[model samples]
Target: MSSLSGRTAVAGIGATEFSKKSGRSELRLAAEAVHAALDDAGLSPADVDGMVTYTQDANQEIAVAREVGIGDLSFFSRVHYGGGAACGTVLHAAMAVATGVAGTVVCYRAFNERSGRRFGQPDARLGGEPSSQGLEMSWHVPYGLMTPAAWVAMFARRYMHAYGATSEDFGRVAVAMRRHAATNPAAWFHGRPITLEEHQASRWIVEPLHLLDCCQESDGAVALVVTSAERARDLRRSPAVIRAAAQGSGAGQMMMTSYYRDDMTGLPEMGVVGRRLWEQAGLGPSDVQAAILYDHFTPFVLTQLEELGFCGRGEARDYVAGGGIEIDGRLPVNPHGGQLGEAYIHGMNGIAEAVRQIRGTSVNQVRDVRNVLVTAGTGVPTSGLVLSAG
Candidate 1:
């Protein structure tokens, strides 16, 4: 087995309040979140020597390090593909620490997506410039596939068809998320849980996709502190050991829309990550006591359950027919409300929740969260990690 397995752990996780508007620069959010994570780990900025984030992150590593008063950075890296890059950030940081490239590493993502950039809006380009993404947009945007919701709807429709799922099945995911959010004080939707009836009654954003099915477009930042497994024992909190981390890209993958694939009902990339995770961790799906499956769209949650071997293909609907994803279910999912009801920190928040579960600190804490499986965005090349109590 590689030294990477059980070599590093996420000793600290911190995030800002999930909100519609942060009312601050993304750089400041990034710096604040990094500082919070360091504090949570009982470390200071001076202790950090490595940083990792998404390629789309505006705050550069050097800039964040300087703002946070870190002396120097020996390692820094960026992952791509929007929300799919969340877990990959920690993977790179863990590798850095496991290999002695850096003593202490921080993985973070901060964005004023809702207030500043407004990712929900359909723009001609990311920054009104022409590039490869622009080329892809050119083909779809002109055909009414402009917004993220519209793009994800195509796959959601296909998933519903292939699995014989109803709109109410998707509503169950939203209801569970809102229930978790209702209890989480840091959640923007705190004390605002919704019922399945409410979810079904919500207006439709796209055909076969209700408004509640889509994830929130909020502004916030989340960070994780990574270090060697030995050092993590000295940290402030119990370590959430990085049992396994893997990133995978399927054949003919695209940004949000990968319509050309032969199999559109499942996320093949997640399957790749899942197989490697289970192998590296020496644990199967049965060993996972809880999960934080990415919920960029409610349908993707069901598809992920199938792809990650939690259930058979086209059986996620029956698997989730009851309130199985709730706190007392067979496998509690999105115990932190997820991006659907909490806030979308580009899937970084989901990783934080997984750490909370392992540490037995989640508001909707499962009875015995020995191992928690966390995944990044779906319908694209994705990433996953298996976290265990250290």
Candidate 2:
């Protein structure tokens, strides 16, 4: 476990233009992002010996490798779950490079989510498969918990009821993310910051969940290059060392609908990952100057802060209330705008932003960022990483 830490680092980060519609194939989006990352790393396609991506990614490893004109591959892997697989892709790639399984592994995720299949729209097919996912979906999808928003709303409403949090509290997160996005040229919401009043005025997707609470159904891609930290130090860009990476499935977990838990106030899966991350990195929440928390929905951001030990349980509402997550605050979160203000290529984009922060080149750069905490989707079996400057 210790061998994985500081052994591998992200040498490059790249992404396609985030938009509602990319007007291209998912494969093309992936290829473009991969090519860009490899170029940023000063590496050629032939140098890539490993590849990792989400299982949900339509652009398979072999397919994208061929498109990029890569030769043989020593490693190829895919992680399960939707957005939860984001950081796992990098974790798998890092494992490959650290253990001498492969060198120069590329991790990517791409999709035409808006123009093609919108995940927000409920489809019965989600519960029809004969696997564990299907079995889990059967428990919630049949009870009007169909879409991602609905699955989240179940726990969200519970969270609100438990913690006395209001819609306004969630709106603050949206406002903050958009505020950061306004200056980020690559953000889908760039130059269009929103107000809390606008967030409260938005239509309801579910009870207690306004439209503003949801993340974008974006059409884009993100790619990262991972290699030995020693090698990355000599690459085109400064390396963001992989201090720690972890994945967790919580007690009584059922995808996004973990309703059976005795207390639904915090994200146990995230806590599991958070503990492992701190132990592996030899650091704690206070060490991170910036964070890229998965903001698929705003409420989970609060819960994650608690679970990650950034704040005490049920103290996140106050923790974020005083602009604690701003660029100059205690922990500047989602400087790339997150899934809410930035485009959601799942959480791949968040990981890319963490790398940039470590390189001291983010659009909303934090001051003297020594360690950056990046989290994948919450509520479900999730993943996270602790990145440091190399």
- Number of the top-ranking candidate, with TM-score as the measure: 2
C-alpha lDDT score of every prediction, in listed order: 0.88, 0.90
Q: How much is 224 displaced in model 2, in angstroms?
A: 0.3
Report the C-alpha lDDT of model 1 over 173-209, residue by residue, as the tens digit.
8888988888988888889999888888899999889
lDDT of 2 by residue, 123-173 (tens): 979889879889888877787779888778778888888888888888888
Q: How much is 148 displaced in model 2, in angstroms?
A: 1.0
Worst 10-residue lDDT window for candidate 1 reads 124-133
Candidate 1, superposed: residue stretches over 4 Å from native: 126-131
True lDDT of residue 252, candidate 1: 79
Once superposed on the true structure, which residue ranges of model 2 sit more than 4 Å away at CA? none
Candidate 2: worst-modelled 10 consecutive residues by lDDT: 1-10
TM-score of each: 0.97, 0.98
- Residue 202 of model 1, lDDT score: 92
- Candidate 1 structure, TM-score to reference: 0.97
